[model samples]
Target: MLGIGVVASILGIAAGLLIDWFPVAASEEAKPIDTLWDVLIIASVPVFVGVSVVVLFSVVKFRMRPGEEELDGPPIHGNTKLEVVWTAIPAILLVGLCTYAFIVLTDVEKAQANTMEVRVVGEQFAWTFFYPGEDGKEISATELHLPIDRPVKFTLQAKDVLHDFWIPAFRMKKDAVPGINVTYRVTPNRLGEYPIVCAELCGLGHATMRATAVVQTEADFASWLEEAAKPPAPPAGGGGGDNGKGLFTSNGCGGCHTLADAGTNATVGPNLDEVLAGKDEAFIKTSIEDPSAEIANGYSDTMPKDYGQRLGADGVDALAKYLSEVTKEG
Candidate 1:
């Protein structure tokens, strides 16, 4: 029985180690997290095999024969030593695993020198990343960008409901509470793009709340940051299709509205292509400024109502004009 259990444990551990279970580890913290997961598998498989082996052995060895159906089995007594051993072993294992987990958590979350701070804001259905820019202003973008090998401390905030910011490759996640800020840190060690998701269900658009994290070379990140900090050039002839599209993306409009022209297929809110097809520029402008004024059919009034203040009159006019033209043309 012991021999069978040992072989089963070995096979189980080997299989567990061999299987690819997680996405690519893209952050320095991911290595230790992955190692902890392996340790858990290693420690767990043997116990599992032991329990399964004992149960099977007892069933096979102590089975009642057909002739003994009317006879009672001999009385069984509890072994105090065995009980103590089982309890102590599991307690020890639990303590050891918890200590190791705590150590790993501390190591990953240790504050490092020269850590960059990035502000992350979560709304009903979108994520906005804010990086420190020149003159103390923040450069906001819908996508997240970080430099490889640099530690980034994200300050997470939610404008409306609760949200969770998660990067699978980084192996770190934190909730964006509505009234307070939550923070987490990660050091990007790989230069690649990874998906950023809202792990918390915020509202009707919770599933569509997604973004991308781009881990880039230091030089490339710096160049991108500098360019993003610069004010966008006014659209030629005031507000045109290109400018409107930029506004739509930057403001996270496409996160809840489907727009064929913008290539966004989100359905959290009304489909802009259909809704704005026959609507005039004035109607589109009103929709942008005050989304609650007229709720679209089959959708909640969850669209942010501060766009009038977020985007000035000229900006709103540009977006409305762009939407009006694009929907009509399509």
Candidate 2:
């Protein structure tokens, strides 16, 4: 016990000192989480090193020799003191950790006055961000834009399967499950573009499920929000279209199609604007609702089998009409 304590203390002290020597950049809102992690490491390191040293010592000292294999070992006996010590210590430590983690989680997610509200909806392979536009109406899109230094409250929910929303630099992540809404807050300290990865494997195309989160100055974010609020620019022919066109990355259309106008870089599908340029509303609607009915030139039949069900009749109608209007004439 004395040896174990000395070794553990020495190793832990060395590591702690090394870590302290490095500079750590703290987040504006993640301070509470960082503090929680620090406490856990302090409490855990000694216990971890002590157990490891003890295990190694036992392995080396009690290792069976070649001649000892045929002989029976001494009668095994359990030590009450050792068992009680392990049990009680682990229980107490776990309880403490749970308490501190819960406090940090709740404190970080608590609503703050003047916090920005954005609705984050996730589907099988896409994410849509919604902001309150003029008249307090909702405007939806595929990209995420947040103002730096301001707390952004995200109301996260799933439209289809389960997906996790994570921004590593911000140190905040939460699951978006169907039928339940999860919330988290982030105050982006940096002004740059970061990738939003789906940490949860929702389906086959999970590997390609990604979006960009742009953190800009307050003025830039405000201007971007205003631009996103404007009605989605007409597609091609002047007519009604789906309102959800704000940002639809899930259709895997981005995987094969190239719609430069929509900022979609997907090369899996045909150039949408070029393909739909001269097509009438019926032609475009049929192609989207019944994609396999007429494959868009070089694209496959994987353009979301249930887009009709996912977006519904009105959504399909608007999208088809919008496509017809937006597709540039060949």
Candidate 3:
């Protein structure tokens, strides 16, 4: 009966493991990582079942009957051989798993000669990607675009505080520590959009710290790189209104604040549409320049503090005016 139960448990667990447990395998690294995960599940389930069966069988077999309340159970001596076997088996299994994991990690992280580089910068609540362009210039973007099947290396730097760069589909993650640069490489095999998330808790806006990773065909990626490498357009409305919109998007405000005109729908902070509704230009300006001065109810002081310097007087004024105009009541 024990043997039959063990077999049933193993079969059941194996069936369960067949279910898709990860996002699509979109990278070369995904195959090995996934294989290791399956091995773990298969090995672990049997151990779990074996222990459960022993405990349950012992409970039922040694259970006291109604008429045996005064009886003393027989004492059993510990088996040194059994103890040694259990300990040695687990130790060997653990060493084997670790060794296999190390090999997988090593193989996945191997660098290629022609690997492209992208500088990833993580700040309070946003991710900025910089790619090498023509004439030693780097083009900056808020979204990450990668060519499918091309090995790309990410050089991560934190502007302030610690953050983590993680792409679930690619199954690669690395830390972004302040005053330090960390690097990780991945070769995307799937052509689709994926979310770039900060895996570490950095600050109030950490939850809202999100960005898009677009895996594109080589042709599309080349076109995007060409366009992005050009100089930016002039601010719309001539007063920097359009520039304000660009700033809002590039600076990562859309990741947390909801703004109708900008099409941002994040709820990590108070919705900018509602927060700015009926609010005056001065209030909106103050909010952007000194967000922590009067934080909206139910929102924390997660807004970046250096926007005033970063945007400059003209840009801040333009953003304030844009917000006021777009969010004003009819």
Candidate 4:
């Protein structure tokens, strides 16, 4: 019995050590919270082995012996001493593990120094990130970029419905609420590109709504920020107004809904300037009313299908006409 126990115990410890590799493959974070997971696994293994070994021993030793099938074994009542031992041991083990988990959570939640602030607004099937540049000037973009090895604090908000901003490699996520802002922080130690996926289901195109998170060096980030701040050149032709703004909105236009003069910086919809360039009146009108008939690549068909109902004939006509004239070539 002594030899069996010794060999089994050594094998059990080796098995536990050998299998410590995480199946999740997200070992990169190495945040203090992840250490709690290791603690839980380590503390539970010995208990698990004890249970299994006892069950196997009982099966082998107490199987129906000769003439034992028709006879009752000696009746033995539960021992209070044994009960106290098992109960107290498990309680102490649980208390210790729970205390460690709480401490880790608290540590990971502590705010860090020099964290970059970004307001993440989640819309149906898309994520729009806004960073306030110098002097309270803001930059809006679709794709996310972060400076490597810096702490980033994200303020999450939802425009229409609930969405979860999750980056698997970072092992962090937060819920975007429509009326309120939820905040979380993460420090990315590694420099690489990773996919930012929405874990929550929002609407029809939920499955297809995805974006990239480019972790760049500090120098690259400074360049990107500068370029975003510079104003675009005015259109060669006159830009539309006097409800040309509404014309822009109803068309579901703007690089990202911005009122850029002619440039499409963040346009998820049709770039009025680009799409209508060299086009005549008739083609532009047809394209607006029947958009799916001409889908734009790199964007989903999330444009309201009931535009014809909401806009009426006159609205669509004016929008297309405005687009055609202003976007005309030299």
Top-TM-score candidate index: 3
The worst-scoring run of ten residues by lDDT in candidate 2 lies at 233-242
By descending TM-score, how would the candidates be arranged? Answer: 3, 1, 2, 4
Which model is ahead, 1 or 3, in terms of TM-score? 3
Q: Give the TM-score of each candidate.
A: 0.81, 0.74, 0.84, 0.59
> Residue 2 CA error for candidate 3 (Å)?
3.5
Backbone clash pairs for candidate 1 read none
Identify the runs in model 3 with alpha carbons over 4 angstroms from their true place. 63-78, 202-207, 232-242, 277-280, 295-306, 309-315, 328-330
Would you list the C-alpha lDDT of every candidate in the order shown? 0.86, 0.72, 0.82, 0.66
Q: Any idea how many clashes model 4 has?
A: 5
User: Residue 307 in candidate 4 has what lDDT?
Assistant: 45
Q: Which candidate wins on lDDT?
A: 1
Q: Give the total clashing residue pairs for model 2.
A: 16
List all candidate RMSDs to the true structure: 4.8, 5.3, 4.2, 9.2
RMSD, candidate 3, Å? 4.2
